[model samples]
Target: MGRLALEVADIFRAHGPAWRQSQQGQLSLDQLKVMSAIEQCRSAALGGHVLCCEACAHTEIAYNSCRNRHCPKCQASAAQRWLEARQDDLVPVEYYHVVFTLPAPISAIAYYNKAVIYGLLFDVAAETLRTIAADPQHLGAQIGMTLVLHTWGSALTHHPHVHGIVPGGGLSPDGERWVACKPGFFLPVRVLSRLFRRRFLEEFDKLHCAGQLQFFGDYAALANTTAFADWLAPLRECDWVVYAKRPFAGPAAVLAYLSRYTHRVAISNRRLVAMDARGVTFRWKDYRAKGRTRYKTMTLSADEFMRRFLLHVLPSGFHRIRHYGLLANAGRRANLAKVRAVLHVAPAIDSTARDLEATVGALPPTFVCPKCGAAMIIIETFTGCRAIRAPPKPRGAP
Candidate 1:
């Protein structure tokens, strides 16, 4: 891909040091690491290779990628690899998109207790789906779903939510037959909304009782048990945002959708328009608006931009994408086999040969010549902080 006009890395490299020093003790280790990674990503600070084209003898330097999960530039390849692995998991069934969002009140405290609350969000949402689907009154089947966590809204606000991609149907209790939902509909949104709210709050309460929660700033008073309970009372009565979109057209469409969301960062470099004396300007969609009016641009000071970007740095080793119920990692293969059997559809094609080929160095080259479209073979490798020699001239060049 051609270089972008601006990037998060640019902002970090230009302003991160000053901003980071200003925050001092306020930033977490994980956040600091993220800033450093994005700043040094694809730069001479990380080691890289020199590539030369066989066709034209053209050459260029190819810097190494940080491969950090939080880095926007690195997730595209990661998402593609993840999608290739999941290609076999898709069955010939309608897939539904569902979103579960925490209310603003809980969202405020979630920053201080990210791991705890985010964990509850994933678990409670999955349990709510399984419980309701298994009820005879509903689908009466054990459904599977893939849930991906997103912690930022369009304006880079702290909004914690999970987007669930679920097959429109499930397997019956006996595993003898396929149980499909009514055409185009997955589950009752209101029902899912209520159950999700109650269950999440129940688990949230338990965490507080066990002293697993932390509060700071204005919420510091919530350390008292009575105050905490009182704080959570209103959330029970309020309607939590849980909604499901219509079914996807086909399994290919499902894969297309997953590609966009599965490994997404808070913001893509494409969204950034400019950075100057005014600040960082970026495009954002205002969902509350209608038609063309919804697309807009906003600017934030360098310090605020970095602060909002870092707001989404997840806890170390936390899995942002999760599979649950029928799609649970442990039994997903067997479950898919059973589902395909009941549907009388052929099973997914085995990719052992293709995988073996990739493992044995049959994969395509990582970089290619821009002028001739030929593979670019590495001629030299350099370590971090080391200078690379000048590129060789193309064939016939003086």
Candidate 2:
């Protein structure tokens, strides 16, 4: 802990109470819980583990992580574990990156109706992709996509967008053959944009009809259907933003990209430049600019910083990362095998054999004891407690 100069926890520990008091009635229970968890994470308040290197007898006390999904410090291990599990799921094919962004008009209403709107966002985006891909004039295949939702832009504003990683080819309609896309292209962006806009607005209208949407402050008038329709009409005339990037270099690069985005939090402590009376200064990318001007720092008041950070806490039980089509969790395993068979690729290799083959020539012994160069053992562990101080000493330590 001493090695790090700053942390999100430090901000919460210092200013959280005052922030909470200021917004007592407005803060959601989930946000309150997240603040408490981050403030207490890896500190004496959460207890810790007592580890001793068997070879060198080096003793260390390690505190517990809060494990809250929003905590930046906790995502590294989660990403690694998730990537390890997904490694075997990788097929030998080019993957495409597609993004679907919510329009500015909807983004405002979405702030107050996150659960309903975000769910529609995911469902509509999936439906749009699947429908377009299945068109005979296009790919004429049932492609798979793994979609992740990100609600913040580079400046940490509430910009809702979905990132989709799709396989370049897919199974045939009869499930009897593999259908490959053009060597470099996935689908027509203009077609995708039009369909996504129409579909999402259609779904948004349904939610509005059901009275699932709420409007407040400047948007209070949108609670009426006529006012809402007038607002949504502009979106129909303007183009929605849905575009795909070039195919990934290989199967490995897909996993590498997913790792960066899958378990990401709003912001990491590393980006924080300072948190003084002038407020918090941090780095951000200005997409509208070019070259050095594109990368810039932004400072927001401490109160404003915490408010924007909490803007992305997410609704309880909401699933931000989702799969659709062949990648749907229910059918992914069987579907992968079917695709491989049709493509005449070798059967899915078991994890053990793949690991051995991939690492047979790699370096070794990075975890040896620092003092004696011998391996160490994790002989014991202890769970956290609210008031606990230190972990239990190794069996017979003084």
Candidate 3:
């Protein structure tokens, strides 16, 4: 039996009351779909079947998962597949993890205008990276990167940020040899931060002019262009957050990093501690502190937990995972070819080789009895002892 995390179960438990009182009026069709899908995720609600263990002749059963991208329980395979596909793109060079975040002032706007504003956020960040790196003063080469949109902070708060994993260097405009950025310095954060802010707000102004923005509650004042511009006035002077972590030790480190961030939902199952009438308790990291002081647990009422979780539900069909520059989807193959030729790197291996490595790589040997050398196998899978069991098969059925 698969144990449901209290954190995840709390989300299901709270949905009842939240749906009855959501301020957004009736739950939209898409929201309802996500809610239903998340609840049915690893449960028999979706129906499942039995799979007897081949080695020990042990009978057991496993419920099929919803396989929804948003389900925390179902993201492992997806992450693995993504990493396999990206392995070929890995060059024998350092890779940097950078983050671009919106100030609290704009997160409100982003909440309402998800598709449009979030898209704009991605565009501005990508353009800023490209423009800055292409300058003669900077690396002066085109870089490749994968960008992921994460809408929640560590505590499940409605904080919007973009996480980018960038190659340490790129090809020069002349397309001859590879060019490397200074070690420990990808780009000037202060300058990149300023440029990002200016570009984002400029595009935001256009969005406002086109009447594509919606204002509600405290943001109603933003309906006026002057008020909106004034609302952004503080950001003009503030230093926007653009963070750069030191480059990973090697290309393999890049894959390890992607495995953690790529398929992460607002929270994961391992963090849950308990759930009861009081609320749900789960672990969270306080990135600001030191040592275990960084690891803390918090409890929230079921309703509050659900509310916070649902706050991160992305708009339907939004592409949260994306590639930019030489890694972009439209012409990545051609571009990568050019990049490889210029760098004198060999062509990428076929998909078959990539798939084999993903499924078999880094796996430990299966459990086996120490004395007899017989493989240990599953005996039974059940939600609880009292749950109904499958009836014995009819004689001669097979």
Q: Candidate 2, after superposition: displacement of residue 181 in Å?
A: 0.9
**Candidate 3: pairs in clash:** none
Ranked by TM-score from best down, the candidates are 1, 2, 3
On residues 1-398, what C-alpha lDDT tens digit does candidate 2 reach at each position? 23357787888889999989989799999999899989988887777666667678876666788889999898988998888888877788889999999988789889899999999999988999999999999989998999999999987899999999999988899999988999889999999999999988888888889988889999999889998999888888998999999999999899989999999988988888888889888989899999999999999988888889999999889999999999999998899999888888888777766677557557454245656766555555676655648988998899
Residue lDDT tens for model 3, 1-398:
24764648446845554654664665666666667778776567766555544455554455667777777788998999899888877777788988999999889888889999899989999999998999989889988789999999888999999999998888889777789999888999987898999999899889999999998898898899888888878888988899999999898888998999989998898888887788778899998999989999999987777778877888888998899998998878887888778777899886775676766766644444444445555454454223479899999986
- TM-score of candidate 1 against the unseen true structure: 0.95
User: Against the unseen true structure, what C-alpha lDDT does each candidate score?
Assistant: 0.94, 0.88, 0.82
Ranked candidates, highest lDDT first: 1, 2, 3
Let me know the TM-score candidate 3 reaches against the reference structure: 0.86
Best by TM-score: 1
Each candidate structure's TM-score, on Cα atoms with residue i matched to residue i, is 0.95, 0.91, 0.86
Error of 1 at 87 (Å): 0.2
lDDT per residue (tens digit) for residues 8-127 in model 1: 999999999998888999999999999999999998899899999999999999889999999999999999999999999999989999999999999999999999999999999999
Task: Identify the superior model by TM-score, candidate 2 or candidate 3.
Answer: 2
Model 2 segments beyond 4 Å from truth? 350-398
The better-scoring model by lDDT among 1 and 2 is 1
